[model samples]
Target: MKTAAILNKNQLSKDDITHLLMLQDEHEIELLYKKADEVRKKYCGDEVHLRGIIEFSNYCEQDCLYCGLRKSNNKLKRYRMSVDEILSSAKAIHDTGIRTIVLQSGEDIYFGSEEIRDIIKSIKTKFNTAVTLSLGERSFEDYKMWKDAGADRYLLKHETANVKLYSMYHQAQSLRDRIGHLLYLKKLGYQIGSGNLIGLPFQTIEDIAEDLLLCRELDVDMASISPFIPSPYTPYKHHQSPALTDTLKTIASARIVLKDAHIPATAALSALDEKGRERGLRVGANVVMPNFTPAPYKAYYEIYPNKYLTTEDPVKRTLRITAMIESLGRRISASQGDSLKQKVLA
Candidate 1:
């Protein structure tokens, strides 16, 4: 059976993507990966853009059923870094020549609008780096405040676009509110980013396709695509995770559909497979985020189970990923000097 390529090469119907998802043979998976890699080379080339990730806080108010940092998870230890500690971490990351610092956290109420604004200001003031915030959901007022305070970008993953599935996973969170916040961020002149999980419980091909379409329609500046890994503490712990191949297919499809958006080979992808990040870059992913938080607080930054490999140091992990990209004939960029428009144009 011949399947269409969906976005660029050919017009793939929804059924083609379904057929691709149903293909389980190892050789078939390899073929898909190879095709995806070729597509990456055709579009993004081999250069990998590294963004420094600093998990500022783990205290979350929302009880998302799939996340390890949900408030109900009593087994996990929680911490929040002070402004000075965060700045110090950013300084170290900057010293490594990384040009963007992504400050991520759960929906922690402890840091209000003013506090977050100050944090963004301090990071920008102290270091010559771009600031990206991943502080979950916030009001429009808060979003405007943060953007005004020098936050160049904001990441808020929709997790899943299907409303019923979204409610099932989020328990008490509303899909409308989450999407509304994202639209609010976009309206506030921030480089907005949103994404979905690959294989959550009750996910279908139609659902994944809709997700890709939504990313296109919303015209997000960046999209993060990662496979769903079950957290042992979550209620959905027994659900099987999506195959890494399916994740790769979704990433490739995303690249084709959202051609101009900045897509990252997410660390979640790397966690599932050793060469996940490298393969992602070879298949239309141009961004790679390296954890740059202090070693003492690294373990406390968990959003999901077994995130970031335990065997290697954080800096070592970055170097290793960079080396893999270099092996693929791509360079790791030293500067985050390019604007979102500039990256899209490139």
Candidate 2:
């Protein structure tokens, strides 16, 4: 099938998505990326929103098969940032002129609902920034409390859309329940971000197509298309990482499909290719998350091995990322970079 024909369509079918993912010819793949770039410029413009991410805690309760932070991974050292320390990191992110602060950690219930609420309230009160919580799944009450406490966004990656695959990757977890959390967060008026891991063991191209379609179905405000990087001591430790080509293709396909959604060129992309961030921006990505997780604690939050810029100084890394974004002719977004879907809803 001609790639241009599929790219020209206003709406894409699962079959069209699958075919685009399977693009192999060098010129054909370039064409796919060009179309994605055009669509990205049309919807998101040239501003690359930088979201400073702080991986506050490494402790997790679930035993996921592919994550280094899984509870069963005794080889990993666990640590949690105190409330004061978390605020310190948020202040650092704020000082750097980043308008969005993402507080990400494993599903650690130790920081109970009240503590989480307090953290959200403190950040909002002190910083002129948007707080995005990526603390994994929690009760509906907790979600509402945090939202009421001024949390602006919630990120819960579905991991995979296939029910059985989701179960296999996350033991004792149900894909249905994960999607339920995403929907509830959306209904609660928090802009939601969700996406899939490309090239997992036993995953197929068709499954990736469905992943993008699921993002559209959920009407997510942000979609992250990241490659699966194997973590040491995990079940898939020896498994090979996804090809950079496939990862880029997924990003391009996602941009073509979820045009108005915020798509971030994740740090995992850089771990795959030296120029991954620049490559992503050239394709369709409009956001780049800079890690602000402070030292000692940052090193231990390894969901995967050798995360890009895991230990770099926050200021230095931000400077380098800014230069790269500028080199691509993209400007840094100064606003909170809220949900693009807001205008449509309003």
Instruction: Give the TM-score (vs. native) of candidate 2.
Output: 0.98
Q: What is the lDDT of candidate 2?
A: 0.92
lDDT of each: 0.79, 0.92
Model 2 weakest 10-residue run by lDDT: 337-346
In candidate 2, the residue pairs with backbone N, CA or C atoms under 3 Å apart (3 or more residues apart, or in different chains) clash, namely none
Report the lDDT tens digits of candidate 2 across residue range 66-91: 88899999999999999999999999
Model 1 worst lDDT window (10 residues) = 337-346
Instruction: List the candidate 1 regions with Cα displacement exceeding 4 Å.
Output: 4-16, 23-35, 311-313, 337-346
Candidate 1: residue 134 lDDT (0-100):
95
What lDDT does candidate 2 reach at residue 67? 88
